[model samples]
Target: MKIGLLPLGRPTFDVPFAEEKLAAMLAALDATGHEIVGPRELLFDEAATRAAMAGLARAGIDQLLILQVTFTDASMAVAAAAGFDQPLSIWAVPEPRLGGRLRLNAFCGLNLASHALGLNGRAFSWLYADPGDDIAGDLKALLAGERPAGRLDAVPVATRSPDGARVAEALRGQKIARIGEHPVGFDTCAYTPEAVQALAGVSVDALALDDLFDTARTVPAEAAAEVRRAAEADVTGLDAVNQEELDRSLRLKAALETIRESGSYNAFAIRCWPETFTQYGGAVCGPTAMLGEGQVPCACEADVYGALTQLVLLEAAQAPVFLTDLVDMDAADNTGVVWHCGQAPISMRDDTAEATATVHTNRKQPLLYQFPLKPGPVTFLRISQAFGAPKMILSFGEMLRRPMAFTGTSGVVRFERPAGAVLADIIACGLEHHMALAYGDHRATLRAVAAELGLPLLEI
Candidate 1:
């Protein structure tokens, strides 16, 4: 058998020992008759994993052997192995605790990788043993086509709620205006529009960013003024932006409103990135917030699935959904920061002096929002469809008032469980970074939503 051998490690561990582990595993595998092809160097981070995976892919190895020499973030492992359709085996090195700091969280890391792979509908076999002492039994079974048994089938239809029939019916006719494709190399932003349509009764329509920009530029000055006046009362970072930049922002919102009207679009997934900042000279985050207040969700990064998730929470809670990245976690306090590049809406902002208009921190351009979100009970709901099945990830937490951790809007969330547990689930499951956050404890409703959609709701 032609085996693609990926010896994995982490910079957090001893790199030299990891390298030794890789060399030893290669020698043992070579002596067993299978032809091995892969990077001679150990994969210690994202760049190495990408380059190595590409090379192994080109080599056309029949099966993948991910030999974990030490603990690495689950993201690193999935980064290289995301699209691998071949049989996979993860050989985790048993850690010998030498009475110091934990040398390697090998099993924990492997556990995470497995959950992430499961999210993508890839089942993998795992062995916690010394690669140097492996018998032929396990290898033989794999050779004879014994595949990993963890099938990420749809989650059982959840117990129907009092509003179950109505919610499902409403979700069935949902439509999202996708304004552009995902940004370059953002694998998490990738989704199968068709699969979402088939599984959740959601349809994504292709729309052009340029068209929105054009319409926005032509919008009447008075209309833009109304938006600016409202922004002035609550937005804070306007001093950094020019009048023209602010005007462009209002125009963009006008343009989006026009598009929403023309297409009867119920929601939006926008490509708010280099183009929004470079060409338009503004960010769409504040406008997205405005739309959310009006019950029209706009997910940044043109993440269609994210928009869909927002729509789910919006309708269910009758409140705004803030799409954000789980940027930081305070293990001691069991809290994490939910943040995005100022894309959150004003309604979600905390009632503090910081609430108001903003510019892009790095670009120093006008039109992004700046504020911290209000502290309250919040629920997280997000989804991804890879390997042809949609998987849902969710959790609940209390939003805390914390200083701005990054540019734009942010919220400090204290999970129901410890931050470490939540972090582990997120890392191990390889869940997408963006989640639709809404205030209030709606676990029951979200659970019903998952059951109605027939997608597995894997809580973080």
Candidate 2:
């Protein structure tokens, strides 16, 4: 079979690592004896992607294979599906858990592509493996147009929770202040206002990223100092990072407080990324963690549904909730790693380790929370649009005490079921990458909430 390969990536991640992985992946594909066509270089932007796609179309390959070299938005993946008539396949390589920065977060790119393609009603096969792994059989299966099937555990029968009605009522008339649009190609963060309002009675207030920046600049020096003092008490090593950036990061907390009070917001969905570092001269991870610890949930990447999921879990658990990404899963160990760039609440920090102030691994910006999550029973929830409809996703797990798997806030979780099974279900269902996690068992309350909302409960 002839394969047209398009390698995708972003500059925000480790480019050298991605390039190395790309070389090995290319070698693996070449060893498959399939005729390969298209550029060997990574496509970092739309113009390059479009040029490559056009060349591949003219090549008339038997299949279009997207080499997910790093974590990127799903825009180009969807574009490829829309433009090509050939069978589509995605292959993402895994990086080692070195207790450092996450290099080549290719699986997340695959996850985003899967959700976007599924949402667009496109059929595609996928593979997750290291470049040197024995995946010749998987490659053959992909060429044969085989897709992985996902399993759905039977929905738990709803039991009455005394606080279910109160929680439901509280959810109504609540507003989420969404600051800035979700990043380009992040369909996982996309939301329909009508769908959101109809399901949760929650209204969304969209605010500009500039608004937060401007407000942060005008924060009174005394107020920013007060925030700094509060942060210094709980988080250690603040003085080690860039002082100017740390001050700016603390001011962001005050700005968020001002916005929350003025808007009467119950939660925030913020686009915490390039602009925060490039344009605003600060990172929001630390401030987001602070708000979450204070019982105000903040979802990174402007994920409105993620914020809503956090609110539901917070109400159900009566504790802080963290929005995290499922970055790694190992069936052999029966565990998976959940992580984000460092916005986990301090309240969730493992007592064995002090929560430390840090910088973004890639951006080198100050004010990120660095610590592993506390070990205990944890419940994961997501308000999902996977498979083209809104549903309630619930999963049970135990947070294991372990060394930091990667930079930022992360934890190794052993699921109630096999880790491999959970991974299969997630990919098969095309579930969103983001899940709201709260320590303790709130499955019963979540079931009642799902029942009240008339949503299909999918437990993986």
* TM-scores, all models, native as reference: 0.70, 0.97
lDDT values for all models: 0.72, 0.89
Candidate 1 positional error at 323, Å = 1.0
lDDT minimum window of 10 residues, candidate 1: 95-104
**Number of the predicted model whose TM-score against the real structure is largest:** 2
Give the per-residue Cα lDDT of candidate 2 at 455. 75
Residue 422, candidate 2: Cα error in Å is 1.0
Residue-level lDDT tens digits of model 1 in 79-137? 65665878777766653322222344455456556655655556676655555655466
lDDT of 1: 0.72
User: lDDT tens string, model 2, 348-450?
Assistant: 8899987888999989998999999889999999989886788889999999999989988999999999998888888877789899999999898888888
Model 2 TM-score, all chains together: 0.97
Clashes (backbone N, CA, C under 3 Å), per candidate, total: 11, 0
RMSD for all candidates, in order, please. 8.9, 1.7
